[model samples]
Target: MKFVCYTDWNQLPESANALFLQAEKDSLFFSRPWFENVATALNDDETMALACVVAGSKVMAILPLMKSAGNIGYALKHRYTPLYSLLLAKDDQQQVLACLVEGLHQLPLEALLLEPVADKDGHLEGLQGSMQAAGFGCDRLFRFYNWFLRVQGQSYAEYMAARPAKLRNTISRKKRKLEREHGYDIHLFSGDDVPHKMPDYYAVYSASWKANEQYAGFVDTMVARFSKAGWSRLAILYIKEQPVAAQLWFVGHGKASIFRLAYDKAWKPYSPGSILTSFLMEYVIDTDKVEEIDFLTGNDAYKQDWMSDRRERFALSCVKSVKPAGWYERFVASLKRILKKQ
Candidate 1:
């Protein structure tokens, strides 16, 4: 297999081909644009992308990683984390993962650290072995759920009926109340509309994150990067003259990725967040563009009602070069082991 390291998505091919063909059907998160757009957004940071191709022709495996200084770099004195690096490929996940691990060792690096992997139910088997075979071990660093709302192949009525009776009642009541008490209107920012209106969306994102004592987690940069790469779009929920909540999602990758969320505190009781999500779900079903949506890697009550299926993700970290010398590194490994207990 020919290993190709690309600077950006433009260099990647259009078809799933040999390596990515399975990924095209199995995973929305592994799509080429998802990696390219996010990597480009984090361009200011130290990140590298490598694609594995078989015999210099077809794409076989894809890996995306960012240099978080907290991880152990080429030298052991400093620590860094390569955030959200993942393997994207199809068929025989075990073999695909094994190949990725072997390829990683060949690259120049100290260690690899991935966080916020989704805790899906079932299907997380043998991933540790793949990483170990590649020179890394498994660890549970952090937990999150990628929420999704099932779309495509279902009518709006059929979709709404699938929810629990209480959920349906609540949603209907809330939608009505929202219309009665406040003239709330929902707006969608398709990938095409993102560039022209993102600045305004960014403002709401910044304010919402700041109020929550956080930033939008690199969202503004990520959106600009994805939108420019022609991978995704921004959806904003506007109330009168102001923006209440905004979501950035992917359209190119078959699994629409829920990348960002920013909301106004004033509309908390009105549940603008859920309302905006419902709007997008409808849009997806109506457009029939994709079969599923990945709220990627997080489990929150607000985001769960719409999810049709659950997936468990495993994080494996290993280094063949040196056993970590520091107590903290050992402590992290210990913590990883401890997570299974919880």
Candidate 2:
């Protein structure tokens, strides 16, 4: 196996793109345009160095990575890029994983930080073992559950019937109360209209609880790229013609992800967010024709109420043996140990 490092987005070989696309999952996040957009938006101090594992003429696997300098070999990861692992073929998992581990050892980073890794397979375990064997220690920062609802072969009525009775009744009550106070309106936008409606979505987002959260600009960049490819889905819910709740969904490859959402806090008493989600689920299943909907991020009550099952996501930190990096790692480990004792 031959390992190649890519410093520029254009330097990525076409075969690597094809190999990633053939993967059953995480294909959208690892796509060519997505990688380019992420590299384009990299911070000044960071540099892109994507690694690819090749066997003869065929690209076997790809790892999305970035580099930076720190007291140790700490690296910064893109927040919006939730999942990262070796995108490889299923048939050659052993060989691909071995090559990937070897390539990872060659990276200049002292510690690799990756989060929300959807370890549907045992890849994370394999990576950890490889890193440990190479004289590195693996630490987990945290883990969260990812919610998703499969809508295939189920009508809106059938799906609602399967939901918890209390949740159903709560949604019904909220819908009725909200409609009685001020009639509601729902608008679905896609294609060219999606980008045109981003300002409207942002207006609602700024008023919601997450208004102080940074990365609106990053969201815009993603929206622009996704919109250009007709992968953007925006759903707005208005009360008395005033926008009260909105959700920005990114749909592709038969799956729709609820990328971001917000609702007017004043309507919290009436649960406008829940009402909008209920309405949108029906549309997402019947109109949008997606097989499943991913409520990306969070293990909030609302997500549990709506989603059928969840996948586990993890944050992995692997520290290699470099003097500066080792010192930094030991200091952090000691600090955490002391805090836990208290």
TM values, all candidates: 0.67, 0.84
* Local accuracy of candidate 2 as per-residue lDDT tens digits, 1-342: 777877876776667767656653454665666766777777788777776777876777766777665523322246676555656755576767777777777765566766557665466677677777777777775556789998867878888999899989999998888778878888988877887888778778778887544876777777788888788888899877788889888778878888788997877988878877888788777777888888877788878778898888766677766456458578557535533442
Name the candidate that leads on TM-score: 2
lDDT by residue (tens digit), candidate 1, 275-328: 777777677666746667776655677566777875554453444535645744
Question: What are the clash counts of all predictions, listed in order?
Answer: 22, 1
Residue 242 displacement (Å), model 2: 2.4
Error at 199, model 1, angstroms: 3.4
Reference-based lDDT, each prediction: 0.57, 0.73
C-alpha positional error of residue 312 in candidate 1 after TM-score superposition, expressed in Å: 2.5
Best by lDDT: 2
